[model samples]
Target: MIRAVGAAIGVVLAIVLASAAWVAVVSSGRVHDVADAPDAPVVIVLGSQVRDGKPMKFLSGRLDAAIEVYDSGRAQAILVSGDAHGRSGNEIAAMTEYLVDAGVDRDKIVGDDYGLDTFDTCARASDTFGVSKALIVSQGLHVSRAVALCRDAGIDAHGIDAECECNWLAVVRNYAREWLARPKAVLDLLSGRPPAVVTPPDGTLTAVSRG
Candidate 1:
């Protein structure tokens, strides 16, 4: 019985390691610094926690990176994707307000309130918003998974690492969490489940593209 349990544990560990490596490989050569990031129709800022209508540090870092991309003329618009119904706060509203304050034109910023997770954000960006190519902005530990999942969702997606002043302990914790999250991302793809919330194409991106 002990040997069987040990073997099962080993298998699980191997699977976890392999999945993490796979995600990293998929995103290899796809992450870029702001200056090197390629031009695209839009930049997708993934959501994080918000408090009292204010973006948390990590989320602000992502928005800052997206702003850099916009200012560089690499992207024509910004898509802030997050949970509108999150208990912490309305992440979409917080993200939108942050961008507007940063001088991003209000019309060039679109919000996806149903982006409850990384996969949902990517899937919805492709299916619901008709986004073909985009730059995804997130922290270093998360950019690989975001890029991998976005590619799997059929978006020509690349990633930018959002710089934030996180302590070593928090950074290590986030990296460890990412290893576990990558396997679930793989499962999400293999299961072929649709995004939890689907809606008609909003024409938001179309308007942005026109401008």
Candidate 2:
């Protein structure tokens, strides 16, 4: 009985990993292009890690991709959302700086300093900023998840994929991580509320407003 139970557990783990592999395989090849209907509004550049007060190489590529979409005239505004958690590190400021350096006008940039994660970013974008819809930008594997959560939050979002031009090895690494994240995301969604907002000492995130 012990052996049989162990075998069954192994099979389940294999299935879970296999499903993520399949999702990565099919979703990897997909990407969204800039096709602004002459009036597409804000283009959100989903934030990535910025270590040592600088844009990581992969993050740089994403910022560049978002700039291209913005320059294509599809979006009038650019939203940079990420963790501005704790006074020690700030992802939003880093993202905003990248936008400025990429030739996106400073005024056109909106910093979502409170966005601690993908779910938080989308939820806050709609609930706090009053954005019902906008073009969401991220790599294909990640973008789909972002779009999925945003849709759940009542945001009319259009995901503009940016993974095609990404480094395949890096994307593969991300896809692998998504396998684990996918289960948690599903659980969070089923539980229903926006996964309880995370608040920083100085600004927005929590519903109570520590400020």
**What number of clashing residue pairs does each candidate have, in the order they appear?**
0, 0
Clashing pairs in 1: none
Error in Å for residue 57 of model 1: 1.0
Q: Summarize candidate 1's per-residue lDDT along 73-138 as a digit string, tens digits.
A: 889999999999999999999999999999999999999999999999999999999888899999
TM-score of 2: 0.75
Per-model TM-score on C-alpha atoms: 0.96, 0.75
lDDT of 2 by residue, 13-78 (tens): 886776556444433433366444233466667777778777676666667767887787766777
Identify the leading candidate in terms of lDDT: 1
Report lDDT per candidate: 0.91, 0.67
In terms of lDDT, the poorest run of 10 residues in model 1 is: 201-210
